[model samples]
Target: MNRLADKVALITGAARGQGASEAELFAAEGARVVVADILDDPGRETARAVGGEYLHLDVSAPADWEQAAAFVRESFGRLDILVNNAGIAPPRPARFDEIDLAAHLRLFDVNVHGAFYGIRAMLPLLELGHGASVINVSSIDGLAGVGSMASYVASKHALTGLTRSIAIDLGPLGIRVNSIHPGIISTPLVQTVGPARIARLQRTVGRQPLGRMGEPQEIAAMALFLASDEASYCTGAQFTVDGGHLAGPYREPPADPDETLD
Candidate 1:
């Protein structure tokens, strides 16, 4: 019941979806949770429900990270876990050549640089805590190519790289950095891509081994395990909760043999 007893956790994009699930689960397991997000009203509600603090943090802004550092330092004195889960999905499905540079950079600003800023800004407090862990939420796109989500795929790959590099840097300091690659999680982020995109996603996911979309809480459970002492030796690794999407392309179910007598 007390997997994270007495810990302090700060999670970005905690107002809703996977972030919200992580916050609620972290609080339930005894971490003093801090919900950080640009969504003020819902963020506050999440914090209240979890018995945590809500900080309005725009992850793309360095100034906002500075404020978050100060708030964490003042409010908790140290932080045991940091979940850099705040990220933007592809603004629109565009082929690599057709994507606008500025639009692509905008996704990188939040999806890539947001994690970079959060890790840099929170390093001190993380070093101050016991068994500190950093969880960067990447995606299935990070591991492989997607036709139209070039920018998003690139950003997630950058984040994955960051996780690996920083793990080595922080290992000596007793901090572990790892990335989570989630596939087709049912979140508002995905919902924003519109009905047609969603239907396409559903059809695609349906062909995978699990044949279903993942839930936010399921991702949160992986976050919980990494945040806890259970994953002490784990660092600079990619944990994929992808429902076998990466296992292989879908194939028709072959019929069983007509006779088996062994």
Candidate 2:
């Protein structure tokens, strides 16, 4: 335990999914975590469960971010880790032309712009921490495109670029930055389709070399490594916890019924 001893971490979207898992794990590892999310009740509960603080933060709003920054400074004195895990995805499948323009714009507001705001708002405290780490949770879509998620793909791709650019900018300041690309993970974000639909999707997990969807804890483990002193030399890097989904397509041709091997 105590992989993150004496660290103060602010994790956005900590009410659920990968964010919640990160908060739990960070606290277990002896970090004082701040769970920030728009979901008031659940966010507060999650914070209470983990003995962390909950801040009601709408990541897209600058004022909310300012308030969060103030709270962190006043409550923690210094911030050692910032996990930009809060994000939203398109609810329905849509071709590029069929996609709603407003929703598409909103995607960037939360997924891309929110991350920027987090980094900007927390920089002061980060510097005070001596050597801080910033973890941006991108997706497999960030590495490649998906058929129906045009806006999500675009936003995550932008996050990957943002991660790289800022890593170089912040490296000199002793703040390490990196992005994570998660494949078909079993999170509420992906479970919105309901249990039955999710079950069907699980069948396709075999297509990935790991042959199963990833768990939120699996992603949290990566975050811990990046946030802790263990990864002091790691920065501006994109880590893939993708179950080999991006490696390549796994396929096997059918055998001919009428043919026999000699």
Candidate 3:
């Protein structure tokens, strides 16, 4: 129950979904948690439920990062974990040749730049703590190719690269960085992509070996492991909890050659 005893964690996008799940788990594990998000009502409610604090944070803004980190410092005196979980996955570009450059830039600003700011802002404080961990919420698309989500994939790929680079640079400081790639999680963000899209995703996921979409708590469990000493030897690694979606093709059903096999 006290796996994260004495640790303080600041998680972005903690108003709901995987972010909220991680906040709940971290708090349950005995860490003081700070739930940061732009959704005031839900964020505050989540914090209250978990006995944590809520901070208004817009991840794309460097000033917001600075302010949130400062608040964490004042409230907790030190930071031991930072979960960069805030992001948006907009609809795929309308046509192959008609990529929305502006949308792509905005996606990167939040998915990639947000994590960068979070890490940079918390570096000093993290350095002071013992065995600090930085967990960036990426996606399976980051590691694999999906025809429709070019820009989203690119942003996640960049996040993965950033995680590896920081892991190398911060190893000496005792701060570990890693990325989690969640696939087909059930969240409001998924619903925002529309019913047809969600149905397609469900069908595609059903073909997976696990044959089901992942729950937010499943991802939260992995995040907690990475943040705790249980994963002390892990760093700069990409963890995929994608219901066997990446496990390659399934074996075709055997033919009825059974007629010959007496």
Number of the top candidate by TM-score? 1
Compared with the true structure, what per-residue lDDT tens digits does model 2 show for residues 44-92? Answer: 9999999999999999998999999999999989899999999888877
Cα error, residue 151 of model 3, in Å, equals 0.7
Looking at model 1, the pairs that clash are: none
The TM-scores, one per candidate, come to 0.95, 0.93, 0.94
The runs of at least 3 residues in candidate 3 whose Cα sits more than 4 Å from the true structure, single-residue gaps closed, are 250-262
Q: How would the candidate models be sorted by lDDT, starting from the highest?
A: 1, 2, 3
Model 2 ranges with Cα > 4 A deviation = 194-200, 251-262
RMSD over all Cα atoms, model 3 = 3.6
| lDDT against the true structure, each candidate | 0.93, 0.92, 0.91
Worst 10 residues of 1 by lDDT: 253-262
Write one digit per residue (lDDT tens) for candidate 1, span 1-262. Answer: 7899999999999999999999999999999999999999999999999999999999999999999999999998999999999988766888999999998999999999999999999999999998999999999899999888888899999999999999999999999999999999999988788889899998888678887899999999999999999999999999999899999977443245463323
If both were scored by lDDT, which would come out higher, candidate 1 or candidate 2?
Answer: 1
